[model samples]
Target chain A: MNIKEISEDRLVIFKDKNTLTIKEHEKLISLMQQIEESMMPILNVNVSYNAVTVQWDIFKMDVNDVKENIQTLIKNLDHIKIETLEKKIVEIPVCYDSEFGIDQDKFDMPIEELIELHTKNEYRVYMLGFLPGFMYLGGLDKRLYKERLDTPRKKIDKGSVGIAGGQTGVYPQNAPGGWNIIGRTPIEMVKEGIPIVRPGNYVKFNSITIDEYRRLNNDKNN
Target chain B: MIRIIKPGMYSSIQDLGRTGVEKFGQSESGAMNFRAMMLSNKMLDNPLSNPVIEMTIVGPEFEVLKDITIAVFGTEKIRLNGSIVSTASFIELKEGDHVKVGRLLDTRGYIAVDGRMNSNHILGSQSVHSQLLDIHPLRKGDVIKIDGANEASLEKKIMSKYPTVKTYKGKPVIRVMIGEDAERVKNLDSFFKESYTIQSDSNRMAIKLSGTKIEADEYDIVSDVTRLGLIQVTKDGNPMVLMNDRQTTGGYLRLGTVAKVDLPILADARLESLVYFEEISIEDARALYNEEMERIQGTYYLP
Candidate 1:
């Protein structure tokens, strides 16, 4: 683990590996909490797979002092008494009908087998981005992995479920995307600022018939 | 209440932003130009956090329903009841009065009423994020409710100091700081010595630029992290300056943040405008930011 200064003195970049485990994510969050408790005017902390960028008010604390404290904390990671984070599981219903799934035929496997493989595994919400309420989930089954489209779609409907590379996630809003779409969820505005499915939360997708989808969809949006 | 006779290019409600929701992948959706918004609110005796109508490209043609003072900010040819009006200053408006704004010189403008806008708030902000609020920009016939008093008081108008963009040889010179991958950037000379032109596709999300390539040692870093005013060097080596509606996180290597003081300048730059990012020390950036906060807080006092 190492701490690198970004953009002069405001943001500190912490990089570990190309990808981080859930525990590493938890550690970074806890470290940020410790810094906040120290009365540092930390504005925001952003974490990718292996990097955590800490944005702060440069005037509040000496940049060098903040860097030193972060280094010391990382060196003594084992001694840090950080509590475990709360885990949440969110259930998502996806409709994989022929009309909604534009690239369904791209997969050679039967739709049922594909759906079965998807539902059996749980995905971890590593981060949410690209669009509001959009989460990038990890833990896709190796057998169901697929590449993105050569030319991206002009507009992908909201609540569209997709798979790209080694990741599987759902789109919260309609926008241009190259991911391979397999289904669409009836949930409109899946999660707003309230953040129903936040980072570190586990997501489970359940397949439903068009009737059930319409029923949930007709319930005036999820 | 106000009625939109013409939607203009784009008009939506926004405040400072919805903070403390990055954990849920929320971007701080706010005014593209904070300085202009702050100044507009201050001049009109309005709360700084009150939601204002953010207009883009072509300004909207609207009518105020009550006797209230309104302020327009940023670079745009605006008229109140067919009369040319100055920006950063409050102009009295009356019932059924027509207010029209023309095409923007900077591609963005702002309209701040003397009070708050009655709109649904999600995540503790009146800001309208498409995903959060599920609403689009203002259109013709849309009614916006404001909380200003019924009677106009011209005495409430106050004056303050604000700076416009400085163009050195016809290019908007933007001051920036170093980014997270500052040490890894191998082409620092090209970044500073060479000027970049803003792309036309630039919007609230980011202002894309194409110029001298400043590729960092690493590009496939991480996804999903805080990036505001970050100048990200994409895999193709183009610089994209993230704005208020930027993603919560990204994977590209960022050069640094554009000083908040200069954000309004960047926002006012016209499409395809040439912009430069001159790096500055963090200490100077802090001092300037503090000065801006002070300027916005109590820019002027009215008797």
Candidate 2:
């Protein structure tokens, strides 16, 4: 892994052979904070293990000053090591009923097998986008990779778990969608009142029967 | 107070935008043209960051419920009681007076009310992200309440000099900084030098450029935080410049980010206009952005 400064205030950490571990990510965050504190008139720093981009507010300081601070920060990062934090295994209950999974029929595998394949792997949250609380989770089974619908549905119901390419995610709101729907999660990924899963949070799906889902839904209401 | 007799096309409340929430997959949904929005607010003697009504290509029609002062800016031709008014001018509206924004030569327009809009702030922003936030667009029959001094000896005045709205003419040369994944872009020089047309499929989220396509070394790149003015090369090698309402993260290989100052040019670009890329240092980009901001704020005059 090599960290190179692309522009005066921009930096990119290249990860070629080595996959970016959680520890490396943490170290990058701490290093960013340290540089931000020492440097006057805040700098915007963004870090991704695979190919992260960092942009700084060069308006406040001179170009040379920002470059010097970034160079120093990169040099000092060698000593800092990120300590792994405890990983939480969240059990998200999902229903793979045919009606809810509108696009699931397109897949060759049966519903039960699809659910099994989805739940088998611990998915990592690569990034969040498109809508609030929408997690783009990687590490899906390659066999489950499927193309998006030819014509996207006008509205994909909220909490509808879908797959596109090799990624799987849940819709936070009822918006236009093109992903292949595989299941529906009872848990709301994005709550209007409060946020559920943020970026960098690991998620695991636990298959549940319709009966269990009904009981849990009723329990929450009660 | 103003009553929406007819909200032409898409109209919504917008401000500077919500930042620091991009990490949560939240877009920085604000006015597409910050300069226009700020100028409109400035003309009204209102705070630059105050929430204003953003009118699309086809502007909105409003009936003044009460006598108040307002200012209009951007591309649309303004009309008061069916008579055309000059752009970038402040006008006093009397009760029962109807104002219609004519068809826009450009894609967007701004109308800054004298005071703050009566709306709840979500995620520290008043700007409406209708698609994700599930907020309804401003429509006909909707009455929007505003706060400000009543029409007491309000004199209609227009500034003698106004900042010229800069636009990209002919083949636009968009300056950009090389992306972190510049290595992924095969035939990098050809990607920049060749002319690309702004595809009709472009929108606030992304502008798809059509022309000669360049292949990327990798197909599926990990999604990460994307910013405005980012030229993301899609799977088919076409470049899509991400805008204000763009997804917080994406998987496409980024070519580079267009200078912030030049973003408005891209936003207001006519469909099928040819665009070319020019590389600039990060220092030059920041300096130019600051210079433009200063000029808009009247700190410095453009000769």
Candidate 3:
């Protein structure tokens, strides 16, 4: 729950036991912006949270001058208390059929058990990467942590949800992938400039029967 | 306008890049050699951010369907109408003139037409992230449209000054600053001094290099935000240079980052080219970056 200055210019949230709430993340951003503005001609500010980074170009200023200014700015932020809002739970309908799950055979778990385990807990978006709209979700059940395939598939179908190490995510588009596929989501995670879920957003998988999935797919097509 | 009679290896429309969308997992897709792209743009008096054709190694052969002014930069051997055209020079293309870009003198080339490309500016950038999106590489018979016909005539005489492109000779020495995970690296100083070779499997996302292995400390680092030019040394002792289309976050320990100005040189580097590393202070790194920027802006004067 504390912001630790790693370097004069770099700061990281000390998340050893307490996770950063969404409000805390936003406050950190605003505070960083304030420091950056106050340091105007002195230093540029770059901020990152859950792997998302933003950089401010401070046209040719001394790094030390900016660092000192930021320390002063941080001291003033002591009174600002940011609180987290109620987490929004999005129910993503997923079809656990093997055909949609291209790498289903790689997993030893039964499809029913996998579904039960996946939907049992809510997951947080750590950061998005690898491909557009791809969400790197944390909080996966520890038992499901699997290694990526030795050789990646040339093309993983869009909507295919997969797991690697201790993370799980839905592939927003068809691209080469190494994660082990468990199911396929019907929702489009990204389109144009908008992302389906931003970092800090909570997500939960809701299992759907093959017939239900087909109905939903048909509905989307229409 | 030009017609691609024979599109060699690969070519695509590119500009500076699309930013502010990486949060959605989109890479800041753009021309790998940003300097070359800008040089071509400046030669034609086009907007610095205007789109250009990025041709890769073994570039395409295009037939001029109509008269136009075009500037080429980046690669070494370029020929127009079967006559050699110097790199970073603007030339008038008459109807029926053919342009052929030989095997990349470096690895990529930029040919900037007089105006913007007639293509969709998806996500505010014309540059295509081929690996991330469905856009295919430019191929034969592709009719590229160029805007601003009058601007072609207003073009100034080619600028005499140009950047001296350095190559990775013997053991290519690339300078880098200590990354956030500098403490994780074992023998940080030795790692920067050792020699490495650009592995053949390198690409826009990451450049794998074979060199002295640097192990990380016991504390495991999670996948976090990364930037281009970051040298992430894996557990296997190989160093990977993260590039333009690299993953937004990574877990591997970072040794340092190659100076931003030197990234274009690293981009065009051929496979198996030996590379070395030199650690520099952040202040020195910033200075070098500013110097390159000034040089690009045509404000830096060489003594």
Candidate 4:
């Protein structure tokens, strides 16, 4: 694999591929996993779509030395093609009832069609951000697309799934959000105090009855 | 037990933040001005990562229920029973002693108690991410549990010679290490030459930059994990410098990240302050950070 690398003293920047294909992402993920498991005296790793920023703890050793170690590791990994994560589909239960789906009427399509389009295709968890456990899931079908609201709500309930423009995600906690809400999930993201849907996981949304939502919500509160 | 008599503007309990939680989509929510927190911790002979009261703009009013050694780092507006207490100096507090701090000279400050703080941690951190967890921000009438007494039984205190606070006289020049893909950024050659002012939309998550519309050659990029000090330039031509409360991943094209050593300086910068970035080697940044750390650890009273 070819790579373009640069550094600002202790911060190293590496970007080999312009586009982040699944294979390239898998390689980056596997590289990160290898780095995580290494005994290298690194500080933190910030992975972006195609570029990776690495910070090292200089107190432990020399920055150049750490860079050399990373180069060697990358070389060894280049010799072996890394495989993508094992396919694990997390089936999420989304309730699109009027009470839960505040933006049901705001949607362009009928509520039933909206839910059908949403639940049909599985989404790829690209990343998690904005809020803890707030997964930025890819694969939003164009038919269900909607831009964000002009005025953001001061409070979007936790477990509320929202759509903004071409993106869709779950609000892990009750917080201020700008996305258009279409449904609610009873899965408590706070169980582990963080979202468990690690990047690279496939998520399939399943429609559940309002009663089922109530049951799951009741189980969570208790 | 420390009872909060008045929970200042934004005073909250924060440590250095959690680690290895980026996989869970969590930003390491920690103290904004880490240097101030570190100095206070060093003064009390406490581990740098120990929990401390992170007060900002204004400070909190509290009653120390137990005698403890405390170190205040930041502005010199802190007082014990109305008597002014110099920052970076250790003060032995007796039971029932009331501590109050006035508005700070900087945007943020820190108060480090001698012992471990009784705080609730989620995902291996006691730091509060107001948007996600409720474990942060000291509340009124809430009781904070801390070590009953000063752990360092030293007869006297020796303070470090480091400046009590970092003051930005004017638009300061912050060093930046452009990412490898920085060549794809708009105005790459002149981005460093042009100056940018801190935008009002800045926060703990990131500092948005005004004046310069620093865009990238290609805007659409993969959303990836982020860290403190990463500068993400949005499509609107705004460059936001991520901080302690930054999200785990972002989609904006990054120009580069601010050096770790200069993060506190940027954090303490006032809104709309003039700022510039000088391209530097990562080694230079590390040297500066090491030099600063050495200065703080120079005259430690304890091993």
Best by DockQ: 4
Every model's Cα RMSD, please?
3.7, 3.9, 4.1, 3.5
- The segments of candidate 1 whose C-alpha lies over 4 angstroms from its true place after superposition are A1-15, A29-46, A51-87, A96-99, A187-192, A209-215, A219-222, B75-77, B85-88, B130-132, B148-161, B164-167, B182-186, B214-219, B298-303
Q: Itemize residue pairs with steric clashes in candidate 2.
A: none
Worst 10 residues of 3 chain B by lDDT: B152-161
Tens digits of per-residue lDDT, candidate 3, B1-303, equal: 888888877788888887666656677768887777776777776777788888767788988888888877766557877888775456778888888887777667788888777877777777777676656568789888777765425535545434664434554567777777788766777776677778888877788888777776642466666666777777676779888778766667767778777777787778777777777776676777777767766733222
Residues B196-229, model 2: lDDT tens digits = 8888878778888988887877855666667887
Docking quality class, candidate 4: acceptable
Off by over 4 Å in 2: A1-18, A26-81, A101-114, A138-155, A175-178, A215-222, B149-171, B183-195, B215-220, B299-303
Per-candidate Cα lDDT values, in order, are: 0.75, 0.73, 0.70, 0.75
User: What tens digits encode model 4's per-residue C-alpha lDDT throughout B225-288?
Assistant: 6667887777787778888887777777878878777788787777777877888776676677
List model 4 lDDT by residue over A1-222, tens digit each.
433334433343455546677666666666666777788775566454554556556678676677677787789778985654578788889998888899878787788899998999888776566676777777899977888888899999988988988888788888887888889999876456656676677889899999999999899888
TM-score of 2: 0.84
Error of 4 at B180 (Å): 5.6
Per-residue error (Å), model 1, residue A212? 4.1
CA shift of A188, model 1, Å: 5.6
